[model samples]
Target: MPFTAGRGDASEEQTDVESFEALEPVSEVSEIFIKMDFRSFRGNVA
Candidate 1:
């Protein structure tokens, strides 16, 4: 049971890495959106 639990932890780590890699692009897109929002806010204020 202990070995099985250890194996499960390893698999969970792998899945976490894969999901993080998949989110990289989405994070970039979010950054772009944040910048655009800030620019629009500035324009409106000015």
Candidate 2:
């Protein structure tokens, strides 16, 4: 999903823009991540 952890400077802002740029394509990846075991967030998780 075009995942990124941009840090320092204005990287968070830049990542927001980059995420929008990849929206259509990354949406698919995002959907996959949503269903992935590692990404699942149901209930209390550590």
Candidate 3:
């Protein structure tokens, strides 16, 4: 979270990777919600 001027490009890339990895679980949760919504939608249609 703390970006220092001394670390420069390498630090920035590392931070980017860290942020991406942190979002991995969020992606999984969104997929689960999408599947649940689809199932409910199908139940309503039927």
Candidate 4:
């Protein structure tokens, strides 16, 4: 149950990916961000 899933659109997810990709140079931070973001995407939002 992703926030994106409920929205039924690719635009929002694309923006999120673009934002995450902007952090690509920061491996450690990006990994952490991706992990936390993954959980958040899976609905562990808080």
Candidate 3's residue-wise lDDT over 1-46, tens digit each? 9765675557655666655653445346446556455645544553
**Compared with the true structure, what per-residue lDDT tens digits does model 4 show for residues 1-46?**
6354454555664656666665456456446657556645545545
Per-candidate TM-scores read 0.22, 0.21, 0.22, 0.22
Q: How much is the lDDT of residue 19 in candidate 3?
A: 54
Instruction: State the displacement of the C-alpha of residue 2, model 3, in Å, after optimal TM-score superposition.
Output: 61
Which residue pairs does candidate 2 place in steric collision? none
Give the worst 10-residue stretch by lDDT in candidate 2: 21-30
**Candidate 2 residues 1-46, lDDT tens each?**
6765645567554656655644444346556566454465544453
- Model 1 residue 3 distance off true place after TM-score fit, in angstroms: 63
lDDT of each: 0.52, 0.54, 0.55, 0.56
Sum up the clashes in candidate 2. 0
Worst 10 residues of 4 by lDDT: 1-10
**By summed lDDT, which 10 consecutive residues of candidate 3 come out lowest?**
21-30
- Sorted by lDDT (best first), the order is 4, 3, 2, 1
How many clashes in candidate 3?
Answer: 0
Best by lDDT: 4
Lowest lDDT block of 10, candidate 1: 1-10
Query: In order, what is each prediction's RMSD in angstroms?
Result: 7.7, 13.2, 8.2, 14.4
